[model samples]
Target chain A: MLNIKNLHVKLEDEDKQILKGVDLTVPAGEVHAIMGPNGSGKSTLSYVLSGRDGYEVTEGEASLYDHDLLDMEPEERAAAGLFLAFQYPVEIPGVGNLTFLRTAVNAQRKARGEEELSSGEFLKLVREKAKTLQIDAEMLKRPVNVGFSGGEKKRNEILQMAMLEPKMCILDETDSGLDVDAMRLVAEGVNALRSPERSFLVITHYQRLLDHIKPDVVHIMSNGRIIKTGGPELALEVEKNGYGDLLAEVG
Target chain B: MADTAVLAAQTVAAKARPAGTALAARLAELDLPTGGFTRAARADAAARLEAMGLPGARDEYWRYTDPAPFNAPTADALAYTDRESTLFGGIDRLKLVFVDGRFDASASDALEGEGLEITTLAAADAAGDHWAADLYGKLEASGQKPVKRPFAVLNTLAAVDGVLIRVTGKVSRPVHVMYRRVALDADVTVHHVVRLEEGSELTLLETGGIGARSNVAMEVELGREARFHHIASKRADDAKVGIGHVFARVGEGALFKSFTLSVNGSMMRNEGVIEIVGDDAVAHIAAAVLGDGGEGRFHHDDTVFITHAAERCESRQVYKKVLKNGAHGIFQGKILVKPGAQKTDGYQISQGLLLDEGSQFLAKPELEIYADDVKCSHGSTTGALDETAMFYLRSRGVPKEQAVVLLVLSFLADALDEIEDDRLRGDILTRLDEWLTSRASA
Candidate 1:
């Protein structure tokens, strides 16, 4: 469902490169986890896929379901069923969380030429989805991510994912700042939404998240390139040992 | 100090002989009602206005916004209110309507209700011994020492239609005064006075433009343990120029809260002066202004002065301005603590959102404290929209215009929070949304 080939990305405001000749792909009905050390350009890969600004894609080919993703804006990508759960969800004061979710859901629906949900329908859907993430009514009423705990923020991200129901989901460091119990809950939310029509590209530095949300394939990235690709057992090997052994082998 | 007081008294006394100006001449020529206490007050105020004349560009206070519109001949009435946006919908309240600056008695509801009494100013020549007589111009006169506000005096002198409301008990419903200009070239002036007795409460709401060139004043007095809430909205048309002044005083243990919303107008100047005269009094004055640049470069100004004269009193001034294109906004807020006014708590904040490169905001926040034990803080800020927040919203599939509107409303949420009534606050917010929507299209 997602494809990337020889992606060369550079910082727009600087002369430095972030992703150099990187390539990876994850088909439908599968979860791919990319393991990398700090400064290995894992986060940059996720950002470029989501169409974030300030990254100059000098040369690349990225697509979703045979559509040219690199040619679309961020919102256009979202309308085309691409969702990115931010590692640090922004705190937006004065914008009610439920209201924001409803706007987003209806906005995508309208963009897709589908019928928009009424207020009543939206509220019911949000409540039902929030129940699974332990998000109370009060949380839905407050400003988005304002005064939210770390785990609660992650759970909110999952709730948005469920409501939007994007075909291609990119979880950028979803395990960051999450405890064991919180990680388990998030993984459960992700696992429940997994189906043949949906795919996930989970980026993380640790194997703990992969333990909960099991990936079908594992890739190790270093020096701006995906240097190794293997089965899920590669993640366990990296967990037992560190990326040091894998990097040495690649060298 | 004595020299200053003598000079002020002499100036007030010298108002008997007037200086020359076209505005003063026109005011003098009006066939005004005469031979009463109100008449005497009007004459004295007219003299003061004549002495001050119309402020010009050289005046320090009028440097930012030109008062030429206020000085020129009255403008022809605008036909813009046709199918204009409405406010206070679905709310049952006492409604008063005025047409072309005259009280449309047939269109207005009754003037008397439980615990509230209202009398028309046109009938003041016939009425006797009213309670509003003593406090009508008192606060306005008291606020004249440090800064000069001849506009209030001009409004007092020239206004032909208004009301005096007295509340003795808790008012069940608010009173809304609606102004509609049907006549072309209508130069309207109105002076409203409100007095809330001890332990009483009242809510007053005003909407619509008074005239093309309007001078208006409102005097409010809160007695011991009383509460008064006031909200006025000026959605002036493009060619309109209005100068409005409000003078208020709070008594012992009383609360007075007011908010002003301005959506349009080529030139609109709103001045408010409030004094907390008794211990434990609480007062908050807030405003939200939106200016869409017009041919005249849309100018809006808010000048506010709040004084804590008694021990343990608290006051807050919050003002927010949203300007687009070449719109100009100015804010001048001051908080003063009198001697021996210990434990005074005063907070003032003024913020401006300059939506484009040409839009400009000017703010001057001041605080004067004579009491050593007082706590006073004031701040002012002007900035563009947060780019990060904008991107965050846009990435969520919201259109760029809708995202900007959301951010704008979020910026105004705090000022709107000062409104105590939920339904009224919501109505104003809806009006703000409509204004933003229209401006976005423009």
Candidate 2:
């Protein structure tokens, strides 16, 4: 469903390359856990795939469902079934969360020629999904992430994903700044949305988030490339032995 | 140099004119009350006004707005005979009409509501009402200095008949005073006095009609525990020129709110002076000015003086201006706190958004503090729309103009949200939306 063949991305201003040659392929019905240390191009991969501005794709191609991903805008990519759960979501003041979410959902639906959801039906669906994530109803009425705590912001991202229901989601550091309970609730929400035709790439620095959402394949990314791919046992190995050993081996 | 030569020639022509001299002579011929205690006050005010004169472009406060063209001598004071109905329908109340500085009795509607006393300022003065003295020329004598505001001084000097409405006690219904001006090429002065007695509450809606070139002034006094809400909407045609001033005083534990909305005019200067004279007094002043066309110039100056003479007084001022085409807009707001006025809270914000390249806006927010323990902040910002936000909205397939409209509407929603009256807020939003849409289409 998602393929990145030797994707090379460099900073726009400087010639410094963040992603030199990344190769990853995630098929349908499987969750891929990409664990890496800081500065390992983990979040860079997600941003490049999500089509954020200022990130130049120097070489190589990224395709999602046989369509060129790099050529599409961020909203177009979102409409084409590509979702990126941002590590730090932008705080948009004066725009309510429900209004923003409904706008995004309706934009995508209109692009797909689907009927728009009425206010009543949308509220019902949002309420049901919000229950699994432990999000309060009052949070939806506030400005988007204006005063939300770090954990609440992350859960709100997941709620958006559930509403959009994209074919592939790139969760970047979704476990950062979350308490144990919040992490469990977030992972449960992600687990419930998993399906045979949907895929998820859960990027994190710790193996603790993987305990809740079990991944079929675990990859160790070091210095812009995935150096090791193994079964779920590899995550346990890295948890016991640290990424320091893996870094030396990969280098 | 050529412009200065042309201006000198015009000044010479104005000075050599028989009609202009006659008008100026008639200004002296008018019997201005100068006998009682109010006479001394009016004499002092007139002398001050003569010294100040009209503001010029060189003045920093009046840089964007020049009041020279409006300073010409007045024409004959035509008795306003016919008052067209209210421009904004759905309003049912007594309407007072003024033309060329004279109140037209035939154009005014008599009041029949209970607990409401609506009478002319001249009548109130003749009756020797003690409350009349509390507000007549009160702002001119005691409020902020009009040393640089020549029009304010002129209004004081040429003051004539005005509407005085007093809510005896707590009143349930609102009092609408529609002051319509229907004469051109004439200098009109209106002095409105609104006295809200102790524990009284009322809403005063004042609308200035089209086709009037005048200098208007008003003074309001709120008694203890009294609540007063004043909303003024001015829509002048291209030929009209006006200078409007409002002075309000709030007693202990009283609340005063005033909003000024100006849309169409050739040249306009609106000033609001709100002084919190007693403890726990609250004052809120807001204004929105929308100017279009090269010939239209609208200026607003708001001065809020919180004496803090008593403790725990709060004052706020918000002013916004939207300029299009070659129009000019200005907003100047100042907040002052006296010495020993402890626990005084004051905030002032002035923002302007210019739509056309040739359009300009000047915003000045000043804070003067003498109190040691007080919370006061003032800020001013002038800029165009946010490019990034506009691009984001347009990228969603929304048209360019529609996206701009949405962003501008959102920009104003913050200030409009502060309005508590649903009907007033809705009316303002509807008018604003219509103006924005028409501008976008044009």
Candidate 3:
């Protein structure tokens, strides 16, 4: 469902390259895990796919279902079924969480040539989805992520993913700040949405998240390139003997 | 030494002479009303205006906002766009319509209601004895100290029409003052006086444009334990130049809240001066302004001064402005606590969201506390939209324009929150959304 080939990116304001020529693809219905250390360009690849600013693509191409993701705006990419779960969800003061969710859901639907949901229909749908994520009425009423805890922010991201129901999801370090229980809850939420037509590219620094939502494949990314790809046991090897062993072996 | 002193005196006189001449020239352009109950107040106001001598560019209060537009002798002609007035349409109200600063009795509702007494300023001035006579310009005059507001003085002296409302008990329906301008070059001034007696409650709503160039003044007096709410929305007339002044005196245990929303205007200035004289009183003044200079020269200013003179009084000032395309916004707010006014609580915040680099926001926030036991805090911020927040919204599938509108509304929510009534607040929000949406498409 998602493809990236030789994607090279550099900081727009600086001459330093971030994502060197590196690529990996995740097919439909597959949950792929990307494990890497700091400054490995795993997050950069996700950002490039989601159409974030402050990055210049010097070379290579990334597409979703054969649609050029680089040429589309962030909103357009979102309407094209691309979703990124931010590590640090933005704190938007004054825009209520429910309002943001409703606007986003309706916006994507409208962009995709679908009828907008009425307020009642939206309230009901959101309540049902929020019930599973344990997000209460007060959290939905408050401004988006303004005072949310780290775990709540991650769960809120999952809620957005569920609401949008995108074809391809990119989880960029969603488990970074979450506790064990929170991570399990979030993983459960993600696992529930897994389907034959959906795909996920979970990016993380640790293998703990994979224990909750099992991945079909694991890739060790380092130096802006995926150096190794294997089964779930590859994550176990890395967890047993960190990326230090893998990097040295690959070199 | 003697020569130096003489030079200083000569400099002071040199400055006064031209100011005097300019004030006289501007006064010559006004046809002041004569032989009425307000004649004495008007004459006093004129004397005060002469002493202050139209606010100059170098004046401290006028530094951020030029007073030239309001001081002009003639108003430029502007076509009065004919459209149905839609604001506050769903609310059942006692409608009072004014056209070109003249009260249109035929178009307005009957001036009598339960526990309410309303009259035109002209009629009140004509009568020998009326309760409004005591409050004609008393608050405006009292608010003149510590600062000079010559335009308010000018408005009091040159006002052609206004409404005088006195509420003795709870008023179920709001008094809606709707203004419409028909004359292209109408130079209009209106002075509205509201008096809420002890234990009384009332809501006053004002909307629309008075003229091409307008000066509007409102004096409000809240008696002991009285509650008063005032909300106003300026007509989105791109060519209009309007200055609005509100002077209020809140009494013991009384609650006074006033909020204003301005969507458009070439040059607009709103001044609010409130004095909490009695103990345990509460007062709040807020404004939400949106300006797009692409339409014309949009310069909007909100100047507020709140005085806490009684023990245990509370006051809040909230002003927010959203500007784009080279628009300029100015906020000058001050909180003053007098001696013996212990336990005084005062808060003030003024923020501006500039949508583009060309737009600018200037703010001057001040607090003077003579009482050591007072709690007074003020904050001012001016910045562009948070790019991280913008991306978060857009990435969620909201279009860039829709994201901007959402962010702008979010920036204005605090100011809009000052309106207590849900229906009134909803109406303002709807109007604000409409304004932002139209600009987004444009």
Candidate 4:
């Protein structure tokens, strides 16, 4: 469902290259794990695909279900079924969490030329989904991520993903600041949303998260390129021996 | 020493001569109303105005705000628009309508109500020795120390119409004063006096400007254990000039709260002076201002001063402004704690959210505490919207314009929170949302 080929990106304000000729794709109904070392351009790929600013696409292309993601604005990309779970969710004071979620849901639906949900319908739907994520009414009423803990933020992101139901999801380091229990809860939430038409690109530095949400493919990215691709066993090998041995073997 | 003293005296006279002449020229262009009970107060204000002269750009408080528009001989005319105003429409209130500063009895409710008495200034003057005679301009005169407000003095002298209200018990309904303009070049002046007796309560609502240029003043007196709430809204009308003043005195255990929402205009200046004289009194003054200069020159100024003279009194001042397209906003706020007034608490905050680089905000916050045990704090900030937050909203499929409006409303929530009534706050929020949505499309 997602495709990238020879993607090269550079900082808009500087000449330094971030993602250089790296490429990987996730087919429908499959979860792909990208295990990378520090500064290996894993997060850059997600940002480029989600159409963030401060990045210039120097070469190559990225697409979601035949739609050119690079040419669309961030909101349009969102409407085109591209979602990125940010590493650090923004804290917006004065905007209630529920209000933000409702606005986003209605906005995306309107962009897709669908009928908007009534307030009652929206409340019922959000309550059902939030029940599974363990988000209470108080959390929904507070300002967006203003005082949320790490686990709550991740769960909130998952709730948004469920609400939008995007076709392709990119999780960039979702397990960085979360405890083991928190990571398991997040994994369960992601697992519940998995379907035949939905695809996931899980970017991580460790294999603990992959243990909960099993992936069909594992790719090791380094120096802005995916140099190795294998089955689920690849994650185990990396966990046993770090990227240093892998880099040596590849070289 | 004698030579220096003579030189200083000559310099002061030399300065007063020019301002006195300018004040005369301005007063010559208008007619001062004459009445029975207000005659003494009017003459006293006129004399004080003549001595103080009209405010000029050179004045300390007028540095950021230009006084030329207010001191001009004739007000600039604006093209009238027929947009219907929905301010306070959802509330059950006693409606008092004014057409170009003249009271329209046909559009107003009956002057008699439970727990309160209302009368026009003209009618009260027709009756000899009215209760309003004691409060007409007393608070205003008392507020003219340590600073000079020539425009408020002029408003007292030349006001052509007004309302006088006295509350004696808990009021169930609010008194709403709606101003409508029918002439393009109408210059209107109005004064309102409100007195709340011991253990009484009242809420006052006001909306719209009187004309192309308006000079308005309100004086409030709160007795012991009384409560008073005031909310005012000025709609978006280009090429309009307004100058308003509110002088209030709070007694023991009394509560006083006032909030204003002002939209686009050519120029506006709102001044508030509040004195907490009795122990355990509370007072709060706040405003939410929005300005866009694309239509015309938009300059808004909010100046406030609060004095705490009794033990354990609390006072707060909150002002927030959002400006874009080269608009300008200014705020000057001060809090004072007198000696022996221990346990006094004062808080002040003023902030400006600029939508673009062209807009500007200027603020001056001051605090003077003569009591060693008093607590006073002040803060001011001016900045653009948070870019990271904007991206977060847009990335969630919200349009850029809609995201901006949401962020702006969030920025203004603090000032709007000062409104103690839920319904009143909701009405103001709805109005602000509508204004922002319409402007985004425009």
Task: Supply the TM-score for candidate 3.
Answer: 0.95
Candidate 4 reaches a DockQ of 0.71
Residues B1-442, model 3: lDDT tens digits: 3233223323334555576565556655666665267766776775666567788899999999888888877888877678757899999999999998889999999998887999998777666567777888788999999999989988887787899999999998999999887888888889999999999999999888688988899999999999999999885772389888999999999999999999868899999999999999999999999988997789999999999999999999999999889999999999999999999999999999999899999999999989999888899999999888888898899999999989998899899999999999999999998888987976
On residues B294-405, what C-alpha lDDT tens digit does candidate 4 reach at each position? 8888999999999999999999999999999999999999998889899999999999999989999999999988999988999999999887788788888988899999
> Local error of candidate 3 at B240, Å?
1.4
- Clash pairs detected, candidate 4: none
In model 3, how well does chain A match by TM-score?
Answer: 0.98
True contacts kept of each: 0.48, 0.04, 0.79, 0.66
What tier of docking accuracy does candidate 3 attain?
medium
The prediction achieving the highest DockQ against the true structure is 3
Residue-level lDDT for A123 in candidate 4: 96
Q: Which sequence of candidate numbers ranks them by lDDT, best first?
A: 3, 4, 1, 2
State the lDDT of candidate 3 residue by residue for A207-230, as single tens digits. Answer: 899999899999999988899999
Docking class of 1: medium
lDDT of each residue in A1-251, candidate 1, tens digit only:
99999999999999989899988888998999999999999989988887778899999899999679889877778888888888988888778898889988998899889999999999999999999988999999998899999999999999999999999999989999999999999999999999999999999988899989999999999989999999989999999899999999989
Candidate 1 lDDT score at position A131: 97
TM-score, per-candidate, Cα-based: 0.93, 0.76, 0.95, 0.94
Model with the higher DockQ, candidate 2 or 4: 4
Which model, 1 or 4, shows the larger lDDT?
4
